[model samples]
Target: MSTAAPKTPKLPVTVDKPTPYNFDLGLLLANDPNPVSVPRTTTASSDPSILESHLANVARDGAQVLINQLLTTCAITSTSSGVLLSLPHAQTPLPREKPVPAPKPETKWSAFAKRRGIKPKTREQRRNLQYDEATGEFGRKWGYQGANKAGQDDAIIEVKFNSKKEAERKEGTTVRGDKRREIREKVKRNERRMRKNQRHSEGRK
Candidate 1:
């Protein structure tokens, strides 16, 4: 007995309801107005080949709808390669299949700021600039040849002591190198804090 070969399934060019898509929101984005993935579960079968064919048909239908939508709404451009369609911003907001991730924990500085109600300062403010009384000009507070390190430029620095204990310890001597040491220590502390925050964040992840 001779058996006839099964013919390949013909992909339908016209979809019944036409899968909704927006060319504006960029590529690979086809938004279904009324998602029926739940209803589709009712037709589930044990046959892998049948399931695969159904999926392929559904995908092909969706693609055709998307292509149709693109051709109608988008601005068409022709090139040596082929045709190009410029998609616009998508209006539809779609939710992800998975749950949204939790917010990252704040760093120590940010937490402290929030607790103290401390506002962020701009770079162009008083902290970033210093008024040079000698030249009567506003100069950078920190950086190369900045006002912060003006003590280093002078041959003899006049040191000021806040406490009686500090005065007794220094004995009214010039301490030009002390400022540099303090800055180095401050920078080291900040680096250590950043490293600790990084480790904490990785641990949470």
Candidate 2:
């Protein structure tokens, strides 16, 4: 008597416009309507090598079914490169595995400006550059190593009796000393703001 050939399980490919496996197309996946009960046989489970081969063959067949179904369901479009397949969006959203990132803490100045609706100057709009004769090049007017931002640093600062009046300058303070003091005060203020911002960020965590 001839023995009957062992029957193989055939998985039904999801022919719907948007397959639940839409996001996993890279793996060439086929969707199973009954996810909890996949139609599988235990014929090769006793042999390790046979089981591995069985799984591989099953994957290959599933991939083929998915490819055939996608070809039939998707819209075909002609492009300069070649034919294109327009796949539909999956009705269900994929589950997120990770938590959303925390927002960065803002600086004191940034927070104040945001509340006041004051837009900061852009790179092109800021007027903080000038020609430094010593360097023979244009540089930032107020940053470190900037053009003689403090006229006091110049070899000969041409001072006019009606020249620019420096703020908080003593009655008898010279131009060079007044300029230096103003720069020092600004540096101290920046340091204080930095410390305050750091404390605020730490408190957020």
Candidate 3:
């Protein structure tokens, strides 16, 4: 009767240490590089398969290493992946400079007329007649005699023959109508001679 109900068994109370919990949480946050996910199997059924799968990764790692080494040698930070690893692009070799154009030659006729203080047309007229070399005087051709204008002074201008035409004339070639007929006659004569020679040779054989 006076005895109190058996003292209820004391339940153990656990007081978690705040310092340890905080320390553990801080350690986890400090060590984590990225959010954790469920770990996946890295090993493959075959060694070759595993190696092949990682080959590209290995190559990328090697490239990164090479880039880092180069950057370190140059005393630069290798943090940025976008930075060029080698020499910066040279100003695309300024398109090979185009050669400058050469100056044009001065016209001889214009220059001569200017020097002589005469108009171009007058100089041209002076050059048309055959001028005497020693006297520097000119005379009209036989067919053109008495045909010059009244104020023209009957002065003969020196005419320079075209080199090609002069050469043709020297070769005894005629350029106009009657000369062409003469050439045709000469060709006919040569053909006749050749036919006669052939006939004579055939008769002898």
Candidate 4:
């Protein structure tokens, strides 16, 4: 037997209404209100005569305004009629100055050399001069000509001048050589690292 086809049900559609906006009507009415007169009255007490009280009130008002101005601009206050202002005064005591010691007179290099028993001709003698690197000492070499002719074999030379001052003269040459060697080694290491990185990167690519 043939079954009857089922009837299709129709779906109902719904329409939404726009929402209503809320507003205050009292604010609008207040905005349109008429201006009214306000009654004036004395802020002070009624014990004294009206004329004297009025004058006193005016004086009090003027004084209060002046005090307010002073308090705003400067650190000040008032009790009755007298004005009071606070000022910051330094309380640090002055440092006492002690008498300076007299400056020492300057001595000339030639006078200093002479005081150290260094003769001008002996001081100018450079042929016998030799530097001992092991002891960082400078003296006349044995069997050398000029100043070493005294026949003293191992006499310790007395250093009168500053060794550091003499060392500073040769410091520039020695330091430059060491720095140049260091920079060259650093550049070589950098080049080796760059070559190694280049090879690794080339393999990856």
Winning model by TM-score: 2
Tens digit of per-residue lDDT, candidate 2, span 1-205:
9999999877565433333443334344456542332335575455577767766655665666678867877788999999988777655456789988888887777788999999988987788877778779888877786654656676776666655565545688887676678778989999987898878767742
lDDT of all predictions: 0.71, 0.67, 0.45, 0.48
Shift of residue 38 alpha carbon in model 3, Å:
25
77-136: candidate 4 lDDT, tens digit per residue: 786978876544434444659876876433344446768986656555645667767668
Mind giving the per-residue lDDT tens digits that candidate 1 earns over 97-154?
A: 9999998877766778999999888765547777889999988878877776777767
What are the runs in model 3 whose C-alpha is more than 4 Å off?
1-50, 75-164, 167-205
Ranking by TM-score: 2, 1, 3, 4
Instruction: Evaluate model 1: give its lDDT.
Output: 0.71
User: Could you estimate the TM-score for every candidate?
Assistant: 0.40, 0.42, 0.19, 0.16
- The C-alpha local distance difference test score for the whole of candidate 4 amounts to 0.48
Note the residue pairs that clash in candidate 3: 127-158, 129-157, 129-158
Question: Deviation in angstroms for 127 in model 2?
Answer: 19
Candidate number with the higher TM-score (1 or 3): 1
Residue pairs in clash, model 2: none
